[model samples]
Target: MQNQESEQVVRHPFGKFTYLLCSILTLLVGTAFMGSSRVSVMLFCLLFSTVLLTAVVSVCHRHKTLGIGLTLVVLMLILNVSSFLTRSYSLTVLHNSLVIIFLAFVFYHILSAVFHDDRVTLDTIIGTVSLYLLAGLLWSYLYSTILLVDPAAFRYDLVNAASEAVTLRNSDLQPLIYLSFVTMATLGYGDIVPVSGPAQTACYLQAVFGQFYFAILVSRLVAMYISAATHKNQQHAQGS
Candidate 1:
């Protein structure tokens, strides 16, 4: 029996993060290099928000959250369309805010799943990575919103193509997304610096949060891995 068991290869099942992470990478890489134009940025947000909302909710498989996601997606579509037709800044901001909420919602649910697991599985590890990425995305939305409200919040090379009315057109969304991830990793690449008081505060707070999250998650994963191994050993002894 032992030899037969040793001969069989163990396969790990794909977890919640597997497909969702794939979608995120695909969308981020595919849309990031599309263009720096305002229209392209908005289109990227639309596609990404829809994909994120749809993908995250699939993990819980809850009908209620699924319904809520569908509603948000519809509203997002409507708002995007209206913003284009009427050229309303309020509609645009509202759309971005809703996307932020969707991200927070997903982050909360994923964390809940991580805590609920007793054993350290592949999904749990992937969940941790997903949480980290989701956090960066959430902060990216916040930074974008702040930039929209205050053009001078961040001082970066703004003459990328014809993006003179930077805040109004939201051509800096991609740059802010880059800033978000960089800040979270505490890279401090001064290519784009936050000048305003609010922006500076946000950057520092994100740096701290990112560090705490990494330390805590690593400990949690280690503890769970040990517990799982111990439990397996007990079961083996009992079977003997």
Candidate 2:
């Protein structure tokens, strides 16, 4: 009975949701780079929103405070759909605001899972990967917001016969998403550069965060694994 309880305690709730998130994020990144049509982008947005809401509800169902917050986020996401369809600039701001809020909630949940006291499980690893992907998504929305306000924030090189340099704008988010991950991973391709001061600052901050997160996560996980193993060995010795 005690062993069963221990196993149950270690079971994380977001494992399946984490897999779904990863798959959707991969598709979104691919679509972004392929120059997908506006309709396709909208479809992806719809799918993403739905999956995000479901994941939040699944992870936060038991916590009263998080559940209430999830309800508000759902309402905001619903409004975002209409605003997205109509292309209302004011509503777009509201939509972006809601997205940032939702991402924050999800980040909190992922951190909870990562720092869980019990033995590290498969779900913990999945949650960690989800957190990394979420970081990219968060930065993508931020860059998108910055570009919306300032059209000349980022400079893009023209790869083809076009002589003029392309400035980043809010029309398509694929490049921004790609740029976010590239910057987060410290892969400076030089194809897309943040020319504005604010943009440069944001990229530098993200790079530092990426390095810090990985270093801390690795050390924490290794420590937890060793502790769990030592405890188990001691238990076996006592039982014998």
Candidate 3:
């Protein structure tokens, strides 16, 4: 087992960080460039960068080899290329990028916890953060589908396809996105109002879950710290 583990190779933190930085820059450039005449070319580049970055992060999980990670990533890339050929690439690329972002966020927390300390305390902290991030992603996906995709069918222009408009100006939907993120972190920024039925319910539930998740993490950390302190105290008393 040890020999096999040794034989398996992985990307170091520096390499992963480099990939992430480049990928983020490419994504930003792509987004900015899309509003111009060269939108298709920019978007294609963006998708390519996203796939590359996702593969890098996924491989860092250490649960698999680089070869395995490359295989999965290449398969995803192939699908993306197919989408482009079939002319449904835009939506497919968007969906794939979202999924990759979620995966990268998760792996980042795991990497932070592992390298920072072998202690279970860090794991708890990372786990706590992951819950909120997941909630935010979920809300964003739903909002994108309901408003941006089919505003007329939904009978609301909560968030239209375009970001520049009066309906978006002073809109409550931005607050929902903020609330979704904040509530997940137990921040509970009360400024955002969820007037709609589904939005209100989702916000409330996410807030509850976020608080509960944090409470659990705090309790576990406290217990572990107290146990370690007590043990040391007893040892000192015996020595004295």
Which candidate number has the best lDDT?
1
Worst 10 residues of 2 by lDDT: 12-21
How many residue pairs clash (N, CA or C atoms closer than 3 angstroms) in each of the candidate models, in the order given? 0, 0, 0
For candidate 3, lDDT tens digit of each residue in 1-240? 876665663322233344444454454344433432344644654555473555356335665545555555666566555655575635554555554454554455544553454344533454434334444545644543334333332222344368643332111233334545676776754544455566556667767866775576556666667887888899999999
Cα-based TM-score, every candidate:
0.82, 0.82, 0.48
The alpha-carbon lDDT assigned to residue 236 of candidate 1 equals 100
Residue 183 in model 3: shift from native, Å? 3.4
lDDT of each: 0.76, 0.75, 0.50
Model 2: per-residue Cα lDDT over 133-188, one tens digit each: 78887888788777777778888875545766555666567788789899999999
Which regions of candidate 2 are displaced past 4 Å?
Answer: 1-20, 26-36, 66-69, 160-166, 234-240
Model 3, which residues run further than 4 Å from truth? Answer: 1-135, 148-165, 168-177, 185-197
Arrange candidates by lDDT, highest first: which order? Answer: 1, 2, 3
Candidate 2, residue 97: lDDT = 69
Model 1: which residue pairs collide?
none
The 10-residue segment with the lowest total lDDT in model 1: 165-174
